[model samples]
Target: MQWYLCALTALLLATGCKKTTCECPPKTDDPKMEYTELNDKAVGFNSSYSLDLNKDGEADFSFSTLLVGDPVLRRDYRQYYIVSKFYTNCLVNGNEETPVLQKGDKIGSLPPEGFHWYNASHVVIAQKIIEENGTSWSGNWKQVAHAYQPVSILKGDKTYYGWIELSFDMQSEKIILHRAAVAKDPNVEVKAGG
Candidate 1:
């Protein structure tokens, strides 16, 4: 009886010392398993901006647009593409600042690149907003955006329009991307694209 008790105690100790086995499976970095949603209640604002004129302090006029297109999923198994256009208007604030306006140029195939940082100024951080799909299915959204700069300013009035494109797998669920672009000249009257 004493020998049997010793053996049982050793067996229990050995069992306890063994490594724990995962019940479900090792955690995977699966994009499909991850669902990200954009927070509709979130507010977006720009902090770093420049005044166009030497005197006026307030932003007379400013606006920006973020265009998200449907995913063009084809050929490439599970890949997706997102194309966005960032447009903004900067109006002269000073009384004497009568400005001439010019239409933005459309450079056929590709837009300009390399001179500026893609996404640096805007803040689109979210605490993770969730949405439900009926009883069993659900989907998520993420706010992905880009800050654009005016291509050319002829007179006093300047309008900026830029393009930003992003591609990712389902793993890019709800990834928040913010952008901000500082004018090259600090003193020049500057306004961020909306």
Candidate 2:
């Protein structure tokens, strides 16, 4: 068709006059950000990792691990908790479990199909239940490396989306946090570590 010639001509022109910036996604983001490098932290057995999600110098969420025993039920529970001091939410599939997202994956306020933004102050993740019969796990974070957790922070009148990179030590039920980042714009999707 005659349209093919026009398309070819347009493509040639675009190639001939290439701009300084390419139209493809960048390999890495150089965010003009305050929280560029995250502090290395771990929480286990009553100690908590207090987080300042927006890098505003105020603690927004506190993460801790707890071990509980129920003598009557002959079971023990090791749980990870995220307690928010402000309005904060995390991604979950409604099974009390947050998925382990990889690098470059999108972190958004609205989750895909089965997942949802967990709208609560206290969220229990990576729950490990031990019983005489066997041991079972919940919340996914066990043994994962460089994993990302999708998060949302609602401060004042706006909601900011972000992500936190984490790793879990199942032996000690410790949660190791490596990095955290927030999108420059409110309510926009951010790459896991960008």
Which sections of candidate 1 miss by over 4 Å?
A: 21-38, 41-115, 118-194
**lDDT of each residue in 48-160, candidate 2, tens digit only:** 87778677787766788788899999999988877655478776675666667888787775576688876665667677899999998776676777788778888677778
The reply for model 2, stretches above 4 Å from the true place, is: 1-36, 132-137
lDDT of 2: 0.74
For all candidates, what are the clash counts?
14, 0
lDDT string for model 1 (6-110, tens) is 999999999889887779867842211111122221222221122222113443222222322334521111111121113222222222111221222221112
Which candidate has the highest lDDT of all?
A: 2
